[model samples]
Target: MFYPLKFDHKYIEKVWGGRKFENYREDMPEGKIGESWDISAHESEMSVAVNGKLAGKTLKELAEMYPQQILGKDIEIEEFPLLLKFIDAQAQLSIQVHPDDKYAEKYQGESGKNEAWYVIDADEDAYLIIGTEDCTESEFKKAVQNDQINQYVHKVKVEKGDVFFIKAGLLHAIGAGIMLAEVQQSSDTTYRVYDYGRDRGLQLSKALEVIDFQLQSGKRKGLKVCGEDYDYSYYCLNNKFALDIINIKTEYEASGEEDRFYILTAVEGQGKIIWDEQELELSETESVLIPAYCEEYKIKGNLKLMKSYVPDLEKSKSQILSVVE
Candidate 1:
């Protein structure tokens, strides 16, 4: 049966991780937990269902067995299109870049990554490394070799609710003291350019091939639309995916789209999703998959949710514009 599905958090430990997630969830394992793969179907890490009759099934299995029900009728892709996660950067990350679709398919046999970060919380001094200062390929190469790359990178101060779109080929790094939720195309291919002298290999050759020095990177001030009971913030809309922030004052009613499924993640506060006489609790840092076949649903609570899905560009644009008009 198609119902809202919740998954077990897959915590990944990293050298730069910390116990920051402990503030929001109690299931955090003891260690430097860097990331929680909340909703994913990638080969690197697939999310497992933890609620309803679908309990214990991996996302990949469901996608393969019930593609139409799980991914929607218009989503022709056999694989689940997006990967959602929470990142806690207690320490700085390496400077890196991901390949575009054409390059990735020909070379790495995978989809390109186009990701966006939604800051949930951050220290007063938290920041992020977006693109780099103006420089030629050779000059940027030299800086990396000489450990002078930091001098050429642009750092932006971040605060809660800040959003950044990291398109493929844009160089970036997550600075320390920040915790955020990330939504991206389902791919794990990354080329690290600089690792702060850590004992890790550098992918300079591949990084140079994919880095787009001219690409502009900065905060995304989403278009806001007010609703009777809530506020909607549309952050990104592209062929890859669409992202929106729904701020529920008391409750919100919605229905599944015919073309694609929706992944609703509660980034702040708590709520319950009701549909077909069934309901699921959604608390901070929790995600629920609302399958395309779901006819209707309602979210009730004082909360903020990050909604992501594969999009039909024209249809999505029209839906948002309709409200503005």
Candidate 2:
């Protein structure tokens, strides 16, 4: 009964949110709808199915009910491994850091957070604060206490299609007038170092504890086009997950080889996801979940989207690189 599952939107109000997502869906929360948890199974926020017999069922319940089929084989985690969302930063977000898995489990009793951002839209003046200048531990500590951290923070102008890989323990912030797609660990354990005069809690000590002072510019590997035939790029390929931007002109074939589930979001244009004689229309900003047990599927149409899934790093290297060449 499970084809590709589309879930109802879970919009979150934030101080820095804007009305940008209104273009995609109506009935957004009254206040600043900063985030839309498109596909999540975190206890903090759960996405529920909107179609099929699974309608009204929470993603967490589905994961539990159909573990292997929903999450994939050998994935025995209690909660979903990844959380995907759209972030609309009207004003600047608080400068923050997140712990690694070890630190998070020991202190917060949750998994750590490692995230990436794909700039969906940016205004002419849009930029972000990423990483910081090299500083001594004592100097950095003083800067945080005195609210002079901006002098040490690294800034970068953003453009559409930009990708930034935010590893755990990195001090970063989403600046004003930027909308982005975030792929990250399910955990939301953020340690706030600075809030730019906001009334939010500051975890200077915890943030400093996990902050990587030696971090330079947060520039990650650039996403490169694969080949002439396929207009796709491998944006991120880490142990946790692999993210690829695929532009389907005619048709695209995908096989669930790793026995892992997949999350595909149409970021641009529309298409029909055809699998086993079934078809579902996918439009911009719409996300669909492909079950782990599903066989080969074809995405047909002139569509541009992102494909995300947990990957076997060693096994996928050759296949992933071959597409680039």
* TM-scores, all models, native as reference: 0.97, 0.93
Off by over 4 Å in 1: none
Candidate 1 per-residue lDDT, tens place, 204-258, comes to 9999999999997789989998878999999999899889999999999988766
List runs of model 2 lying over 4 Å from the truth.
217-229, 276-278, 321-325
* Candidate 2 per-residue C-alpha lDDT over 96-166 given as tens digits, one digit per residue, 9 for 90 to 100: 99899999999999889988887888999999988887777688788878989888888999987788888
lDDT of 1: 0.91
Could you tell me how far off, in angstroms, the CA of residue 27 lies in candidate 1 after the best superposition?
A: 1.5
Candidate 1 RMSD computed on C-alpha atoms after optimal superposition onto the true structure: 1.2
Cα error, residue 18 of model 1, in Å, equals 0.7
Q: Extract clashing residue pairs from model 2.
A: none
lDDT for model 2 comes to: 0.84
